[model samples]
Target: MQTVEHESFGSPTEIREFPHGHAEILNVGDATIGRLVLEPGWRWSNDVKPIAGTESCLAPHFQYHVQGRLGIRMDDGEEFIAGPGDVTSLPEGHDAWVVGDEQVIVVDWFGATDWAKEPAGNVAAHA
Candidate 1:
């Protein structure tokens, strides 16, 4: 067993950033944890879809909302808002965005590997 501590979202193995959002990825043991910060006016379609090359976000997520508010809209037209202290398990084929003026923070234990990743063969496209 081992222990790793940080004052905040520090010492990340990888960090993916877009125009209005960013994900700090930390590798611990066999898990990849992602700390996502979505600024106000950030929307998955407008911010991340081009990188992913998908109509909706294809990365499924199991995360904990840390602060602010986030809105989610599924492909089937289902929609909801997730706020602070909420635990969410979002499947693939969804769009998400920040709902308020505050930045939305989330810690995801799943789907961090490909979140915000530029599609294969399109490395310089989103850069």
Candidate 2:
């Protein structure tokens, strides 16, 4: 029997911003999907401000909004809004930004291997 407690990991962390305030974590597991809960006023950057080697490239982001609102916009003038219980697949080379004063919890299903490439110091802040 094996169990991994969430609190055992200490605090939530932020990996790095890509584009449009949307940050990401690499090495996201395949069996266990990455979960992200955004609080009120929680705004993520998607500009890839810190993620190295991604400025010229794009990240493949797929997420589902459980109980809040989320917005995704790409550099090519593409955008979309997601609400509670909404499942969405973000287009490659785009940015995602949260909205509203509600708590938004997004369970990312891109596998657990994705978060392995996040920023250290700023990681917990992204939570």
Best-fitting candidate, measured by lDDT?
A: 1
Among the numbered candidates, top TM-score falls to: 1
- Indicate the residue-level lDDT of 46 in model 2: 32
- Over 1-127, each residue of candidate 1 has an lDDT whose tens digit, in order, gives 7776553467688889998989998877777889999999999999988787778887889999999999999999999999999999988889999997999999998988778877677442221
In order, the Cα lDDT scores of the candidates are 0.86, 0.52
Per-residue lDDT, model 2, residue 94, is 53
Q: Give TM per candidate.
A: 0.88, 0.57
Over 1-127, each residue of candidate 2 has an lDDT whose tens digit, in order, gives 6555442122334443333333333332224455665566543443332443243214455677777887767768787888888887754555555677776767676532343245455342122
Off by over 4 Å in 2: 1-32, 46-48, 51-57, 119-127
Pairs with backbone N, CA or C atoms under 3 Å apart (clashes), candidate 1: none
